[model samples]
Target: MELQQMRYVIAVAETNSFTRAAERCLVVQSALSHQIARLERELGARLFERTSRRVRLTPAGAAFLPAARQCLDAAERAAAEVAAAVGEVRGRLAVGLIPTVAAVDIPGALRDFRRRYPQVRVGLRVGASDDLVEQVKEGALDVAFLGLPTTARLTGVAARELARDRLVAVVAPDHPLAGGPSVSLGRLATEDFVDLPAGTAGRIQTDQAFAAAGLTREVAFEVTTADFMDRLVGQGLGIAMFPSASVHRLTGVAAVEVTDAPARVEYVIWSPVGRTPAAAAFLDLLDLPGPGGSAAHAARAALGTR
Candidate 1:
């Protein structure tokens, strides 16, 4: 029932070993066991199944885990809010971003954020844009950086557009199109392509462009990471369309402008209902320019600015 007991339970559940959990919690094995036993007695159910070989959560423990986590998170957030009221921002900041994020240097930004808010713990997750947006909406992430085709729409979250970029065609140096003049979508569509997995935001942007152009293309290779996509292109496997800003950073591939290409908008999204103090501080550090003024004003206008 106590917050400390909940913390101990989480540690045990995560480590799956009472001895390891005790080490993780910086408590003796006996004290950790005693506290968990006390909690089980109060709840009138055994939380764990202890055997000579292993310790695992019982059905009741599994059912109680999520609620326990929520309660602990709530308590921590409350304490963080109290500290923020007096000008100290100390909390966990969970930030999610797409792999091809170019509008802001993520590592640099994290460095600056850490320097400015040394007390805050920051965690980074790299994922697809749609997944990151869902995490933000679900409150699993405090904020997220996303890239979506201009034609796409986002709902139920507050967002600020960071930048807009046009995708360029990337080809191997020995390929036919390398070093050639800018190519049209029609011409590029004829070539094999290496792209992110189907249905991903990055892939969908190019797909929509091709569809709009009355064209269809083959994605010969589907890879998860941009590095692998670059490797495939360098090996003459296929061509790819990626943000123009990032193409220059890739070696062994030549970038050709696409006459008719897809454009993606970068955005930073957060929950409109519960804006954490740490998240607010990070947003302020960005100091992004909105359509008319600061990013703060633009986010208030929702997706209407973009």
Candidate 2:
């Protein structure tokens, strides 16, 4: 069967609508339907069970989906390899970033990478640490910057420790604990907290720290962005626990060290098996030494460079 037919099937399975899949594939609906029909005739197996209301993959479709995706990925990698052989780093690199990551100068790194490899295309996605991690695992992203537990490991990926920073207590300047050198989780047990949602790495780390301390704080606001959470804490709505770097520059919020909190580690993680040339170049930039020069040096120390 043609590679186009495999693509059409995969798109239909992902979007669950022939019309939408056709739109995504940039073809007319009738053409896409005809191609799928031809593919099924060639294979003698129906790939989808369609109704006017919805589309669902058949048992056969489910069985074929993973292989279809692998085929597409392999084709793309082959093309990239040919370009790399010519000393060109030309391919799409999808990078994921967590909103609260502060150890890396991502914009600077991208700028330098683009300057060096003008032919390479880059795409960026920002999400929670867990979501970004999953995207890396699913091949939607080539690499991701994540805040993971010190000892936590993800299956099927290789990670490099970029930086280690302490989780701190964030409070409004006027809050009672603002002037403290450090605060204990036990002391904040009765205070209202502004926190990230349950599935995020930040929230998970905070929860574990509280559990370890035998204290539980009331969460008054669940914010998705670190900047918004800083504003919430500044408004005196509640306090929060966040990585120290995330709150270092807040105008009205004070980030006090959490004397008993666990340290959060930032990692640059990627699939070691299918790394693209662009990904390899970017990772090399992350290793270059310097403190504040080019993007390559912006977070160099975090990458364990001298």
Output the number of the lDDT-best candidate. 1
For all candidates in order, the CA lDDT equals 0.86, 0.80
State the displacement of the C-alpha of residue 58, model 1, in Å, after optimal TM-score superposition: 4.4
Q: Using alpha carbons, what is the TM-score of model 2?
A: 0.83
- Residue 261 C-alpha lDDT in model 1: 81
**Candidate 2: tens digits of C-alpha lDDT, residues 1-306:** 988999999999999999999999999999999999999999899999998899989999999898888788778777766776555666778889987788898989999888877777899998888888778888889889989766567677767778898888888999889888887889877789999988677788888888888877799899898889889999999998877787655667887887897788998888756577667667777662222223223223223353
Pick out the ten consecutive residues of candidate 1 with the lowest summed lDDT.
290-299
Superposed Cα deviation of residue 58, candidate 2 (Å): 2.8
After aligning candidate 2 to the native by TM-score, how far in Å is the CA of 176 from where it should be?
A: 2.4
Q: Deviation in angstroms for 249 in model 2?
A: 6.0
The residue-level lDDT of candidate 1 at 247 comes to: 80
Tens digits of per-residue lDDT for model 1, 76-164: 88887777766677778999998788998888888988997889899999998989988887778988998999988999898898899
